[model samples]
Target: MKLLHVHSLPLKDVIIDLAALFKVDYTRNCGEYSVKIPSTWGTGSIKGINFQGGLGLLIYDCNFNTDVEIHFTVNDIHPLKFLYCLQGKISHHFENHTDEHPLSNYQNIIVASKGNDGHVLKFHKNEQTEIYSLEINRKLFKSKMACELGKAKPNLQEIFNDDLGDKSFYYNGLYSLNLAEIFEEMKNTNFDHLIGKIFSESQSFRMLTQQLIQFDDDSNEDADRIILRKAEVSAILEAVEIFKAELDMLGSISSIANRVGLSGNKFQNGFKTLYGKTANEYIQFLKLSLAKDLLVNTHDSIQEIKYKIGFNSHSYFSQLFKKMYGVNPSIYRQNYLENKKMNRSQKDYK
Candidate 1:
């Protein structure tokens, strides 16, 4: 979508217009607000409190302001987001993603898929905040970056590290400055030239993403060689898929080791090196994910669900579920159902 001209309108009007264009539903009550938007054009739902404004970056008058909390419910499978915080703070809660380090005020946080959820940020208000958001399309970015790097799959982590370098700062603040500078420059430049600059930078970013992916792949290969005598990243990945398919049978480390033709110690260490988790840990993760799905989509009783997922005891399942999700399974299910009801009621109001 072409960036909408938002120079002179009231903030609320601008927000509403943008929401409409994006097919998002929003309500502003007091200083607190709420927004429900599709994570992508066609699918996924992101619901959150727009305490000041919803989660995303905004740039106005060279300053940055982002104060919104977005709970990514569906279709947000990737880890990177480019947001412009317009007026308030924003906290992002991740599902299974973690940051390598805390983001500096002007750096970006690389989202790791294996990381935990609940990653968040709070952007303070700034009158001069005039921000724009760009949610990087990972597949597209990866493809384009790979072309630039001359690799089929590149390491995005290293690419971002190299590009941002010591200048790394929190993702929001860094992008705030970059975007503001670009937008300001755009205002003074010819339209064609402005578009050209954006496209060039975008292409550069794509290349950077690819490089990082390649770096990560190489890192894995190196680590794998140290533990497995011979590195077979592809085979390990295949084994992981197989293990996922028969998660219930993965109770023993020996079974996993035998499948990969390695001794128990080698398999354990190699799996951790390649995938960042032990065999049992990975199995538990699969089980947790399955439990989450069941909690959300089915009416199965907790005990029944636990037994089905190979958890013999209800209390143990509940504890593990809470540890991972921050809420018990029953509560999680209840909350989801309540939200669904609330959404329906809101729709009826409209």
Candidate 2:
């Protein structure tokens, strides 16, 4: 399906038009909107909130049956975007480039400037795309921000200073769990009441704050100096998928490198550059994170969880868990259970 000329319209109208084009069930009240498109177009739904002025949030949980393309223009005042793709891939095409920028699972991208002409958004068939998008008006941000950028914990002065319409300033990396959870919370309920509105705006601002802080940690000012070949990056991503599928296997560096047709040194270096962690470190992180989830969400023993993640040594597992989270696995699980109980109690009292 093709959606054209969506630029120049207000965001609300734009989304409404999109729903109409897809023949989806669309609803809007106050500033909150939800669209339920046909399963052929996509499954699940697309939800959004368009706040006053120029702040907006959109969440997509979908799998398209065929490729879909969106080409839209932007306003004269450039809008910045924070996009986190928790799953699947999206391809973006700019007017000036023959190539398209692909955003895959766990990837976060910041488009600091909207380009001059229209841009394209392409979604592929059978890809389960889960994405969170936040749009900010740069001019509004500068005017409304209460503090000076120079004194902020995360310096975003460089982003603030980029001339409007310059798309050169972009940052991309793995989407942290912190960001994923914040957006997930926004989607788990309907924030339509007065108190809900206040909470929604607060969460939106919090998401923005976290994005800036993450941007500070992940930004590369000299991207030209350290660029990975497309094939290399693609191979590394394939390796990542392999790791995800076989978290318990803990494949050797050379094996993964050989599978991807790269020297061990090159694979390690490129993995570190793209993911901000060595290949081994990334695998360990995934295992530990999955273990933590199982601990909190399942009624499994610590030993079982350890073995599930392929850790044979209990001492080694506890040591790594404590080093990363500052708590033992059992104690961490207990704390999580207690906190959950307390939250339930508080809600009952209310």
Candidate 3:
């Protein structure tokens, strides 16, 4: 494992410097940042935007060739961070903490501190993790609230006041499915330029508000415990990745369970509990989503796509596709083409 220590740098500079140290191609434009790490390190790109008024938004979706640990030491104020992991695992251990905080899929953590604060984060090898993080400067956030709403509202006051007004605090919990869908939609959108930036910035704040509501809610304390062991959870998530990769072969649940060293019943129940859907349903959802993408983006015929994705009957595939997307495959393809052409014409006219 490779370890790096960063001392007292702004987050943007930290990322840029890290990219160079890791030998990755990095880009920044109009406040948005992107880093394309090589396959030897992790074959994916991390991209997001950082805005003024003390807000920083980032998304990390990658699988690394080796586990890496990065430790941060802040010489100034500690920023409040809301970090949600969607697909893999990342561990954070802040100063004065004995044990690491493991954030897996669907889990979130909030961190703030008054004194100089720092944390150590570890990314696992060969596991593709998708994480979205929002960081806010505490004083700037409060000032922004006062300027926009005329005062620091009660809830805002409470957040900044919690832990005896100490800025350094930690809250860990799970986020709702609605929040996950919003991120998914944002990731799937094709818009770019000023329009994309504005939309992303707006949605980032919207997500922040929603996250803060959940962060302060008292009901989250009673959330159910995850029944599966940590090893089981890791195994199941790996199985999910395999399921998506080999959809054409249609791997059976029993096979997946066997591979993961879990019994079939435990596998099914545990998977549903972790992912909020049955294994079959999730796989079908993936299939339909891929089918839609092929329909819109590829020249493959509906029948060909159906056959390619392991569906024998065109009618059966069409029925499921319509149920999921509210349109049959052919119509969906037609509308996608029309929209593309119209967009082109509008851009040309402009």
Least well predicted 10-residue stretch by lDDT in candidate 1: 47-56
Q: Report the error of model 2 at residue 112, Å.
A: 3.5
Give the lDDT of residue 272 in candidate 2: 83
| lDDT by candidate, in order shown | 0.47, 0.73, 0.75
Tens digits of lDDT, candidate 3, 1-350 = 97867664456776776687678767887767788877668777776566766787878888888998877776776567788888989998776665788999788887765467577778999988888878776666666665654454565565554422355567777775446767888889867789888888887888887776555453323223223433457778888888888888876888877887767765786788788999999989989989988898789988889977879988999999999999999999999999999999999999
* Candidate 3 to truth, TM: 0.59
RMSD of each: 22.1, 12.8, 14.0
Q: Which candidate number maximizes lDDT?
A: 3
- Evaluate residue 287 in candidate 3 and report its C-alpha lDDT on the 0 to 100 scale: 91
Q: List clashing residue pairs in candidate 2.
A: none
- Candidate 3: where is the Cα deviation over 4 Å? 147-156, 161-167, 219-350
Deviating ranges (above 4 Å) for candidate 2: 1-4, 23-25, 150-155, 219-350
**What TM-score against the true fold does each predicted structure earn?**
0.36, 0.59, 0.59
Candidate 3 pairs with clashing backbones: 112-167, 112-168, 113-167, 113-168, 114-168
Which is better, 1 or 2, measured by lDDT? 2
Model 2, 95-119: lDDT tens digits are 4555677789767777653456555
